[model samples]
Every structure is written in structure tokens, then in C-alpha cells.
Target: MLGLNKTDSKFLLIVILLTLFTPFLMQPFAADSGLDQFNGGYPDLMQKVAIFGIFAVGFNILFGLTGYLSFGHAAFLGMGSYAAVWMFKLLTMNVIPAILLSMIVSGLLAVIIGYISLRRSGIYFSILTLAFAQMCYKMAYSVLTPITNGETGLQLSLSDPRILDGATESTSLPVTNIFGLAMNSSYKLEALNRVFTFNVGFYFCAVIAIIAFYIAIRLFRSPFGMMLRAVKSNQTRMNYMGLNTKPYTLAAFVISGMYAGLAGGLLAAMDPLAGADRMLWTASGEVVIMTILGGAGTLMGPVLGAGVIKYLENIFSKINESVLHSWFHWLPDGLEEVVVWVFARFTGEGWHLTLGLTFMLVVTFLPGGLVEGIKRLKKLTKRGGKPKDKLDAPDPEHTPTPSKHVV
Candidate 1:
């Protein structure tokens, strides 16, 4: 760890507090209110939050550090998912090989794509990546049937041959296991007079998410990370300094692609299916949204953003007529019908519109994302903290003082 004084200590304390408190902040959404008409539980959604957190973290390395916006990153993610599913089909359901194969395949794909895409920079680079991704999607949906399984999505079936010896000839995809420790999809819980059940997969994802966070933190502090930051701040200057920035940028791209691959592999581990939808442009855009929404260039911000978006996608869209009836029927006959009519439009297909509006508002008001907004609110209201001890304060010893107190 970098040596730090009292100011840095306070900043670290705040971060620790936020991390410890975030689950509590998110606890209300996790509960089975009438809102949880479907599969609404902290454990289940937390898995999604973690997996996509891996995804957005990967994207941040490229877009955040290298300042290279990629529109094809999801293609790598899809390839990884497909690879992971195929591993499950042909080998053991243990996630180790699945995850490794997924990462390797995605890295190889990134090498090819990044080589071509890196030829151009700025908007042209982004367009090149986009075009490549669209090509991948098209091939998956059409000519790549043997590999990708096309439209209906690639599914794990026992009919497929397994070359791996000692592997189970499974009718169902092998249950998630390590060595011999089986990971089931169901866990029991009792709360008040109610009973609850959830999946072990959720906890697996949570553990992985913490690992992902630790990796991102290490990357943010490494010298390589600082060089990547320099590239973002001034590419021409870095070039003039005789640094071959291309290799660094390409490495970042591949690394990020692999992170996306890990995320996709995790998804496949949970579901044992791969879909062309994983390669969609919207999927790529989701990472960008996640990074910016959570706070671009800030550790843990993208995870927060991914959780917010996914929570909305799943829970925010489940309000149907029955859900409406259960809610406002107690009001009165006339008011209930009218209220349902109005609210129903905002659910189902209308969820995207609602999200779009939320995106617009967030971007317009908090361009630095929710993290920045929270920072501002803290500064404005929390007068208890000293300004000199603020997290973003410049290092005092490093700062040029008029006095010759070099010691």
C-alpha cells in the first residue's frame, strides 16, 4: 500500500464505510414487497450485480484508461459464454476450465480484433469495433450455426459427444462443483413467519465480484495503470516521450476483453446456455452505461451502475395487471382501475422508456455519474469533515510551497 497520512486515512475510512453500508442501502430493494411479484431477492439479483460488475470493470480498463471506446467488446463476452457452455457440454461442469477457456478464447479474439481496430483511433476505432461486433453477431445468427447454434440460443444437451475422459455423461449440465463439492441452485432461509429459498450460485458470484474488485483496485494503482492514464491524458505527449503506447493500449484492450469474457463465462456457469443476444450492440452499450452511471474511472462505481441497471431491468418491469390489482384495489373500484391503467403503461414494454428517461436525467444532472453526485452531496451537507482531509486533496508535501521547507 502507498504510504499515506491522516487525510488519506479518512478517505480510506469513508470508502470502507460505503462498502460496508451499501448492502444496507440496497436492502429495501432486496425484500419481497409487492414489488417482488416475480423472482425478486437480494441473493439472486446480487449474482447478476456481481457478474455484470465484472463486465463493466473490464470495459473500464479500455474505455476508462486507454480512452478507447469499443463497440465490439460484447462480441468477446458472447464468445466466452459460448466457449464456457461448450466446456460444460464436453467436459465437467466445474467452472475452472470453462472460465479459463472462455478467457483464452476471448483474448485470442481480442488480439485479432484489437490489431485491426487499433489501426484507427478515436471515433474510427470505435466504429471499427462496432462493425466487427456486428459481423460476429450476424455470423452467430446465420453462418456460425455449428459453433454458436444461432437463433434459438446454444443449449447444453447430453446428445453432444464428450471427448474428455472421466467426465460424467450427464443428461443435465453438470451441477456447479469444485473437485466434488456440489453447488446447488437452492438454499433455504426462514424470516419471521415466512420461508425463503435462493441459489448457491448467488454467493459464488458475490465471492467472484469481490475478487474482481480487488483486481481492479490493483490495476488502478499499478505503474502500468499510471502509464495507461498518461496515454489518456495526452497520447501525443506520451509518443513524444518515446513510449510505444500501442502495445500498452492493446494489452489493456485484451485484458478488458478477458474481463468481459469472465463475466460471460460466469453467466453461462449459472445458466448453461449461450445466446447471440450476448453480442448485441445493446449489450456493449450496457457496459458503457454501467461505467458512466456508476462513475467512470472510479473503482466500484461500475459495479454499482450494473446493479442499478439490472435491478431495474428485472424488478422494475414486472408490474402487470395482477400486480396492479394487488396494490391499488383497496383504494376503491373506480380509482383502482384508473390507477392501474396509468401505471401499467409504465411497466412491461414501458420499462425501457422509463430507463431511458432515468439515463437522460442522470447524464444531464450528474455527468460524472452517481458517485460524483454523492461526493458533492457529502461535501455540501457533511461539514463535520475538514476540507484539507477531503479524499481528492492534493498531496501537501508534493505541492510546491513558497518556503524552502524541502524536508
Candidate 2:
């Protein structure tokens, strides 16, 4: 189905089901429940999960397949955001043009960056990309202030000429929309003592994310993907075999960058703003962490990693000292204080500490990331059942004879 084998088709179906039910799944806690604060069904965070999922998936295409780590993808992401915002400002509030422009602009930038960066391999390549990203970030903050709006960031203004959208008499800034459907429009469902929000923007992003995942799966199984794997396994060997790996690598890099751009455009579509912070080195590092934590080179790993990180950022970071005290109030005063102090360092403003610890553990124990951990657990479970009877096992007498090798 959809050019995918049975396993991949089933996987894609699972992803679609999960995405379709995201609003319900994310809002597992009822509104009146104590765990309600942990629910991440809000449109904003859901949009982010879908957006960054696209970002991490794209990064995985390059790094996971080609083993070329880029530390500058955030530059493309920012560029996409800037382009989308400009599209909104100069063209229309419609998201189609904004998304299209974002991908094109980012793809062009990726071509130039990839051409230069692909000249080197490994750490040198990573550093070159990082330098380019930092350069772009500085340019946006300084010389390109006219276009980027400097440190204040680029945002929609009332006076701008939205050529395609036509002039409006409204005093407020126009909201981003698809035709007449506002991106922020949402419907709330109240049932079973729970409230679930279905947002237009999140579904839009989710659809795009699903498409991206499908593309990634197809690419992973294609001959081109095989060539990429060859490059990662040994570029020198491929080159010695009369293959020019540069074009393939460059293509992968650009595709990956375009994916980042699409994610950036989605962000702007959700909220019409672009900032230099999006292009920061740390922002680039975050995607790297997401990809690695989810398992590089695996189809669903990046998305899983993105969801986990975003969930931690939104839900776990909300755990404050007061919240901790409330949860631990039953304990002795001294012990509660001690517990809060220890727990505080891993939540709230220190959520990164938790992330850091998780990344360290995953890299140390499950080097293949969360996907590997899951796979191992599955294997363990399968082995945990009652031992197979000797008669139930494959019989050597009935097995086919081994083919003799001619020497």
C-alpha cells in the first residue's frame, strides 16, 4: 500500500491512527482531575509536537541515513519562518503561499550550505554548518535588521500591504487562515468528565506531519535511500566504486533542510512571527537531541523523540516548588523540603537537567535510542513465556538439507 511493504503499511496506518486520535490521547486526564495539569491537548503544544516532529524527521533523513551531522539546520528553520512571515506581510494571510515560499527559500539556502559543507565529512562538516547558521543568526540580528526586524523579531503589522488578501477595515491584525477557516479555530468536546480540544491548526500540522512521515518511509525504502546508506556506511568505498556521493549527500541535505523550512512555515502559520532565537545554535542542538533520543535511522524514532521532548517541555516544566510541596505535603516538613529540593532540580526551570539525564542514559545503555529500548523490551517479553516444547520447536529431521558449496 502506498508503495510500502506490509510492515511499513501497517506502521503508517498506526501513525495515522495515533495522529487522528491525538486530541483524545493527549487529553487522557479529565478537566476536574488532579492530573489535568499534565494534559497536553492544548492546541499550541500539539501544534509544536507536530511541527518539531517534522523538524526532527527531516534531520534524521540526513544524519540518520548519511551519518552527516549538521549543527545549523535551525538556520533553515528560521529562514522558512522569515519567508512565511514575509509572504503573509507582502502577499496574503493564506498559509499556502507562506508554506510554499518557506520551502523554496529554505531549499535554496540548503543548496548553498550543503554544497560547501558537504566538501568535508564528520565533525568538520558539522562545524562548517554550525558556522554558517551562526553567521545567518548574526546577520539576522544585525545587518539584515531591515528585513528581519532585528532583535524585536518579525511580526505582522496593521499597515502592511497584503496584496492577495486585499485591504481590510479591521483595527486588529488579521489572523492567519486557509481561505476563511482561521488557523486558531477549535472545537471542544465534553464527555466522560473530560474535555478534548480539536484544533484546526493542529490537524493541519498533523496531516502535514503524516505526509512527511510517509515520504520518509518511502525514501528509506527506495534505491536512493540505499545509496544514502552506502554513503554513511563508507563514502570512500562508494567513491572508489565510481559513484560520486556528493550529489546524493547534497540532495539529502537539501531535502532535510526543506523539511525544517516546512516546519518553520507551520510555526509562522500558527503564529505570524519569526525570531532570531529560532536560528540559535541551541535550537539546532535540540533537534539533534530529539533525533538521537528517539533513535537515529529509524522511521518512527524522530517523531517519538519530538513528542517526548515537547511533552517534557510543556507538561513537566510546569512542576514548580509550590506544586511539588502540594504533592509532598503529607511527608514530614524536613523530608518534604529535601524532596522538593532534589525534585526541583529536575523539573520547572531545570527540565533540561531531566532531558540531559535521559539523553545520557539512552546514549549509554540504549545507544539506538528509545526505539532500541522498546525493541529489547519486546524481545525480553517474547522470551519470558513458558519454554517451547521440544516437539513444538523446529525439527532438524524435517529441516531442508544444507546446500553444499562448490569449492
Candidate 3:
């Protein structure tokens, strides 16, 4: 886990804040002014943020706990998504079945995969899994075209027979009316013509994110988690101590795969579409990036890393000089021009460049990642907070000691 330095503590606090109040934070009137630009609401993006957070959290369970880098975790995620979509087509539109089926399918897949891959460790295991994932991907894209819908992706077809709880074929549920709140509304400041959208999809994601965070926290504190960490630090040592590291490692792998599946299911449940592209090797790498960027071993780091990545993707890419011009209308033209240009360079098509640079800088300077950087900053601040004073300070014996006698 990222060292429990003050900065890391703040990182935990930030995750808690974001996940807990995500709905309000996404609203226009909330503390963050960036919300006003969205007229349709941020719920759609929020759903994605939550799903990815779930994905990263699950990945951390493997790499963070056992230090095993399979590099094919996305296979489970993709499989889960397909399973979820199938569930939607066959059963009711309710997410419970989709999520459950996703986990079960992923669990089975992981069992077979881990059994084979775990025979070897390190790069060999990673390559073995990668080969397997690629094999699966090709099958889904071609031979299994009928099942995967050939690359156009799977969708909810009313034509399909939902044999289980038929949820009125005519009515596909609206984007999660969780508490029945109208999620598609927008708040407008008429005079300024500013609008803040409230997307229903975002709330659905936020709630799920909160639940995922809680689960991660519990995992970090559990005895199983301790054993997993031991396996990572030194598997031989654990084995020498009579602990069967194999069982622990295998369990962690399966658990992590299940997590990836859950994330995938959520993605499909939020929007009834499952694509084979999600199983690509690049997608697996993305999860690794998320885990590392946030601080691999820390519970909250993965979520933070995921949010940061998604934010850059959705919020950062959408940014341009013109958007900046609108945002900085309150500033003078020359100053606005400079600010807009500088800010725009960090976004748009080259957003990946900015993320890569930021990631590199953090890794180089902090090594421990963003969580570590915060810790260093907090230590410095704490040191600075103390008022000037020398140790012993002469004990005040040489002066001012006579003042207390009168009182």
C-alpha cells in the first residue's frame, strides 16, 4: 500500500469525498465551476468513471497483492460485459442478474486461466495469459461472430425472447431512475446563459463507485489480504513458513478477475452494449496504468488513478482554446489568450501525451506515485507548521521564573 503518510491520507480523503458526493459535485451549483458547461449533465461520464474505478480496484487485488502481472485481466472484463449483455437479452433488465452472471463467468474463466498460467510466474505467465487473451479476442471477432455480433458490438434487441422476467418488451428502462430523481434536468443561470446538466447515468455510476470503494477498503484490512501481501513480498518465505502460497495466489487471481467482470457488467448495465475491443491487450495495459498511477498497493490509489485517467479522457480532451475563451471571459483578452493557449495544449488529441508526461514525472520524482507526492508535501508542511523554538530553550531558568509566585 502507498505509505500512510499525510499526503496519502489526503488522497484517501479525496476519494471518499468524490465518491460520496459525486452527484452534487457533478451539478452546476456545486463547488467545482467546471460542472456548468454540461447541459445534459455529467451522469453519463460518471457512470464510466465508476466502472473504470471498479476495474482498477480489481486489478490492484492481483498485482498489488501477489505482484503478479498477468496482462490479460481485460479478458475477464470483456467476458463479463458480454455475459451481462446476454443476461439483459434473456432475463430482466435488472442489473443483479447481469452482475452475478458476469462474476460467475469470469470466475470460471479465471480458474482455467490461473491454473495454466500460475504454473509459471513472472514474464512467462504474463505472456501465456496474453496469448490466451489474444486467442479469445480473435475467436470473438471472427469465429464467434454470431455470438459477439462481429465487431459492431452487442445490443439489446427487443426482437430477442427474454424468457425470464420479461420486463415489458416495449419499455426499456430509462437511464437508472435509482431514487426516481429526474437525472436529465439542467440548471440554468438565464442571464449568464450558464447551464449545468444532471445526467441520470452519472448517479448510477457514483452509487456503484461508493460501494466498490467500501469493498476495497475492507479487502485491504482483511486477513486474506495480509496473506496476499505476504505472497507478493516473498512467496518462498511464506511457503517456508508452511503457508501454501499457491492457494492464496490463485484465490487472489480469481478474485481480481471477478472484480474485472463486475466492472464490465456495470458498464453494460449502465448502457446495454458490449464490444469485443474491451478485451484487447491495450485495455489490460490501461488497467495496469491505472493501478500503478494511483499507487498499486493502496486501496484508494486505483480509484484516484482511474478517475484521473477518465477525467483526462472525457474532460481534458473536450478542452480547447475556444472553450477556454468562454471560461475565461471574465479575464482580459491578452491574458485570456495566453491562458487559453497554454491550457489547450494539455488537452485535445494529444491528451495522451499530457497523461504520459504527468505519469512519467510522478514516477520519476515520487516513485511511489501521486500518493507519495502528497505524503512528501504534507511532511514539509507539517515541518513548516511548527513555530520557531530551540530544544530545551535554556529551560527558561535564566529569566521570567519569578512571575508565577504572585499568582
Candidate 4:
């Protein structure tokens, strides 16, 4: 069972199945259907979902388990991207070396940042991390321009020497690959008027995401995870008990950073570009929102949150005024125009409004996030009707005592 109990084993199995069938699941709409715009089976969007899913999963390990919220994780993510791109520029176009160097670079940076930031707790810690991320972002734009390529961003160039790859006769920049297989290579299967694209890049990211999820599951079940939960419950109490929680917290931070690094590296592997904007505070905040919206502490919450947010960003944002007008064309002119205007505010460029509303509703009603909502739905289905009154319901813990002996 891969060191997991029955429940966890089943959960892991479900995750694996979902990852494997993502192409089919995401392309539920027919290619020529009205809902085709909602289809996310394309390579680029699918790769993003898997990549950011890894990012959120990693962030959950630190914030969800240890209660240490960081606002600078994007710094590690950006660092990883830069490291990966440099590897591509100087070493080779192969993704393995780039991914490895990315994790190492980001992990090292996390050590220093965590050491300083973990010295404080709560808001102070958050502010410290945010400052560090902004500093990194600024450095990438100005001071580290030589490395990050400033505003132009670091990208593959034909003039650069790829030592491991040797000399190339082609004038064009090389694409990222594994061995000889190109990352962007894909196969499209047409059936039932639907096109399911099976992309090499998406599969690569999906496999990595599955491994990351498995690792997160193991970490959640381990004794160290318990220690982290204890820290979350009360680090001050653990301190009073003579336990040094710093090392544990620092380790969790570094591990989380490494996960982000892997995510960033994968992004580079898929696109072969690194931009300073990846280190922006907004990018860091996006992961935080993803983690919180999906149920922070739960195993599947982060991934679900990432998928939902990314879906909204990709699909909902594409719904323009023209699309809205088409959908409402059956209505009278005035009514259709009004409806389009109302809907336009929430879709297209204003998709963030929809996301904000969704986040607010989930937080206000289901504080545990989407996972809690799903759990409640499952419970409701099991009940089959309204829940029984507390007085009418038999208590499983308290059974009636036999009084026949006394009689």
C-alpha cells in the first residue's frame, strides 16, 4: 500500500487515476459544441494546472501544517526558474539537470530566508517574507538584470553555448526535451466529436505532481508531520516543554521551497522562459489564495483549489463581451445588452470578481474550504434526508444499562 493505510491508499489511487485521465476529464465538451470554450484539455492550460497544483501542494506543507504563512514563496519559485533557465542556457536543453539545479538553488535560498523570517511569528513573519520577496523581485529587475535579463526576462538564445548539448547547426533556439523527446510533442485522439490532446509536457508535469502528492501524503502521516501539527497548535507550549521547534519549522520551510522550486523548474521545462514577474507578490498571494480556497490543511485541498483558480483564470477570463452577446442573443436587444453587461463584469477581464465572490462564500459558509463542502455533500447524501434531532437520535457512545440484575 506504499506505506499508506486503506483510506490513504484509496485516495492515492484516485489521484493517480485522475492524473492519468486528465485529458479525457478536461475535454468533457465536444470540440464544436457551445461549451467548447470551457474545455481545458489543451496542453498549455493542462500543464499549468499540474504545475501550479505542485506549487500549492508544496505551500500547503508549510502553511497548512506548521501555521507559518509565508508571503515570499514566489521568490523561491522565481529563483528556481532562473536556475533552470541558466542550466538550459549554459549546460543543456535536457530538463533533468535544470530541474535538479532549480531545487538546489531554491532550497539554499529558503534556508537563509527561513532562518531570518522564522525568528518572528504571525503578521511579523508574513511581513518579513513579503519584504524579502519584493526585494528579490526588485533585484531581478534591476541588480540581477544580467542574470534574469531584466524586463525582457531570461529566455533561450541561439548565441549561447550549450556545453552539454555540443554545437548545433540550426539557427533557431533549441526546445526543451527529455533525452530525445520534445516537451511540446502531443497526440490528439478524436472520438465522439471531441478532441483529447495527450501532451508530453502535461504528462511530465502530471507525473511529477502525482509523486509530489504521494510525498505530501507520507509527510502528513509521519511523526514529523505530527510535530508540525503540534507546532501549529502551540509552538510556545512546545518551547516551554524544552523542545526546539525552530529546526522542524525551518526544515518544513525548506521542503516547501524545494517543492515550489520543482514547480518553477517544470514551468521552465515546458516553456524555456523565466521572468522577474514570477517573483511578484501577487504570484505569491495567488498560491496563498489557492491553498486557503481549497481547504488549507487537507491533503487534496490545495490541488483542488489550484485547479479551480486556474480554471477560472483560463476559461472564465476568455469569456469576452462578444461571447456574452452571442450567448444572450436569443433575448430582446435591450434585455440581452443588459444581461451581457451584467455578466461581462464577472467574466472576461473581470473574472477576479467571480473568484473573489467564490472565495468569500466558501470562507463564510464552509470555513474548511472546498474539501469541507464536498465532505458535507457526502454526509448529506448518506443521510438521505434531514438529519435526526439530537434527542431522537441514539447516542453511539452511551448505551442503556441493564437494570434486570437490580430487580
- Number of the predicted model whose TM-score against the real structure is largest: 4
Backbone clash pairs for candidate 1 read none
Candidate 2 runs further than 4 Å off: 385-407
Distance from true position, residue 331, model 1, in Å?
5.1
For 1-407, candidate 3 gives per-residue lDDT tens digits of 34345754575667767665665555544334665444223666667778899999988988887889989998999999999889878766667777889999998999999988988889998999898788778878999989889689988775666676544546644332233343344343323333334455565566666666666766776889999888888888987999988888888889889989999888887777898898999999889888888888888778778878887787667776677787889988789888878777787776888999888887788777777766666766777854233433557766666665665
lDDT tens string, model 4, 301-362?
Answer: 99999999999999999999999988989999999989999999999999999999999999
State the lDDT of candidate 2 residue by residue for 1-407, as single tens digits.
98899999999999999999999999888887778889998998999999999999999999999999999999999999999999999999999899999999999999999999999999999999999999999999999999999999999999999998899999999999998899999999989898788999999999999999999999999999999999999977998999999999999999999999999999999999999999999999999999999999998899999999999999889999999999899999999999999999999999999999999999999999999999877766777753354437778879877889979
Off by over 4 Å in 3: 1-17, 26-41, 165-200, 324-345, 385-407
Which wins on TM-score, candidate 1 or candidate 3? 1
Off-target runs (Cα >4 Å) in candidate 4 are 387-407
Candidate 4 is scored at a TM of 0.96
RMSD of 3: 8.2
Question: How would you order the candidates by lDDT, starting with the best?
Answer: 2, 4, 1, 3
TM for candidate 3 is 0.79
Per-candidate TM-scores read 0.84, 0.94, 0.79, 0.96
Clashing residue pairs in all predictions, respectively, total 0, 0, 4, 0
How well is each residue in 1-407 modelled by candidate 1, as lDDT tens digits? 33434654465456445444333434443345553344445555656777898899889888888889998889988999999988877877787788889999999999999989998899999999999999999999999998888998989775655456355555554565645555555656655433454556766666676666667777877899999999889988998999988899999999999999989998888778899999999899888888888888887678778878888888768776787788887888988899988887777667777777778888999988878878877886786656446566777878776787678
| Of candidates 3 and 2, the better by TM-score | 2
Best lDDT goes to which candidate? 2
The CA lDDT of each predicted structure is: 0.79, 0.95, 0.77, 0.95
Give the range of the ten consecutive residues with the poorest summed lDDT in model 2: 383-392
